[model samples]
Target chain A: AQRVTQPEKLLSVFKGAPVELKCNYSYSGSPELFWYVQYSRQRLQLLLRHISRESIKGFTADLNKGETSFHLKKPFAQEEDSAMYYCASFDNNDMRFGAGTRLTVKP
Target chain B: GAGVSQSPSNKVTEKGKDVELRCDPISGHTALYWYRQRLGQGLEFLIYFQGNSAPDKSGLPSDRFSAERTGESVSTLTIQRTQQEDSAVYLCASSFPPGPQQFFGPGTRLTVL
Candidate 1:
């Protein structure tokens, strides 16, 4: 069975501190991984995709096929970056999402 | 120029009653999807409409749930004899065919008493 796992339900970090939100997946085929974020009172939006290999809002995610991980990382956490983040994978006709991780950046 | 839209932003219904939720996909988008998110839970894929055909219905929880899309535009998801388990936020999304990025609409929060 294809599955996406987000091990942390809530991650708290101090402002200016580095943060990482871990995501791992189990799939038999080549995986297309994406990171989605939902800010308070805002609709969910795409953050980035592994294929693009681009960073948004100073955040980046590296997809490591060897470890089956696509962990999102930010060199320095910002207060405005606090939000709910989800990792997702698309396999053929089905799209699987991991339970989101709530990141709280404290000032 | 509007994005995907969903009707009845909030719906409160008594258990055993039927309800219908509507979704209007972005114009010219050939792929539409519906998902259910219970409180604090990950999104659960309900159904998908690619053009006028649904190639996958395996994610729908049960027969109590049904959906239809006409002219590859508006779609409706109806639940018969709604149950407490049916209470969730129903999210609608649309994108171009074979596109990996999907735009989401403000979800409909359904409450079943």
Candidate 2:
């Protein structure tokens, strides 16, 4: 069974501080990872995918094959960055999501 | 140009009743997916449909839950004898074939009393 794990339910950080949302996965084969975000009153949207290796909204995630992790990172957190972040893994035509982490960037 | 859309943004029903939720994928999208999100939990994959092929219903929680898609257009998820635990925001997403990215709908909020 494939699984995505996001250990933090809630994470708070002051503006301009670095932010890291932890995500780990369990899979036997090569995995396709993604970071999805949902802002206040906004529909869920794709932030980025490992295959793209591109950053959106100043956030980037690197798939660490050795650690089996794909943690999303940002150098400087912005107040608008506050939102719910979900880490997901795609395998065998199915996508599995983590419990999600609520990120709050205080100004 | 429109994104995925779901009907009956909100539905409230009594326990043991049946309810149907609808989703219309983006035009020309060949892959459609259904997911369930509890109040404070992540999205749980319920099912996926590709073109006119048979859908992957492996993620469905129980036998009481079933879904159907008309060709590659609208899809309906039906829940029989709904329970309180069945309450959640059911989301629908669609993607093009060979594309990993999925576009999501606003979701339907289902409540069972």
True contacts kept of each: 0.61, 0.67
Model 2 residue runs over 4 Å out of place are none
lDDT by residue for model 2 over A3-94, one digit each (tens)?
99999999999999999999999999987999999999888999999998998999999999999999999999999999999999997797
Structural similarity to truth (TM-score) of each candidate = 0.97, 0.98
**Residue by residue across B1-113, what tens digits does model 1's lDDT show?**
58999999999999999999999999999988999999989989898889756446778899999999997789899999999999999999888874558899999999999
Model 1 lDDT at residue B96: 88
Q: In candidate 2, how many clashes are counted?
A: 0
- Predictions: Cα RMSD each: 1.0, 1.0
Q: CAPRI verdict on model 2?
A: medium
For model 2, what fraction of the real interface contacts is kept? 0.67
Docking class of 1: medium
At residue B17, candidate 2 shows an lDDT of 100
Give the alpha carbon lDDT tens digit for every residue of B1-113 in model 2. Answer: 48899989999999999999999999999999999999888899999999988999999999999999999899999999999999999999999972458999999999999
